[model samples]
Target: MINHGKELFSAIVPTEQKGLKRKIYVITKAFIKL
Candidate 1:
């Protein structure tokens, strides 16, 4: 059970990180355009 939980966590973290990075990129781009 612990190993399965760790696998799920590893999978989720990268996707969330990618989403956050994209959001930051978009915000930065908008700020630059302003």
Candidate 2:
């Protein structure tokens, strides 16, 4: 059970990180266009 929770938590962290990275990438592109 503990292992399962840890895996779930780890998986969520990466997806959240990727989401933040993608948002930053889009913002950067917009700023560059301006």
How many collisions per candidate?
A: 0, 0
- Point out where model 1 deviates above 4 Å: 1-18
- How high is the CA lDDT of each candidate model? 0.60, 0.60
Give me the overall lDDT of model 1. 0.60
* Model 2 C-alpha lDDT versus the unseen true structure: 0.60
User: Residue pairs in steric clash, candidate 2?
Assistant: none
Check candidate 1 and list the clashing pairs: none
Question: Model 2, range 1-34, lDDT digits (tens) per residue?
Answer: 6775565556556667579776556556545655
True-structure RMSD for candidate 1 = 12.6
Worst 10 residues of 2 by lDDT: 25-34
What would the per-residue lDDT of candidate 1 be over residues 4-33, giving only the tens digit for each residue?
556555655665767877655655654565
Each prediction's RMSD over C-alphas, in Å, is 12.6, 12.9
Q: Which window of ten consecutive residues has the lowest lDDT sum in model 1? A: 25-34
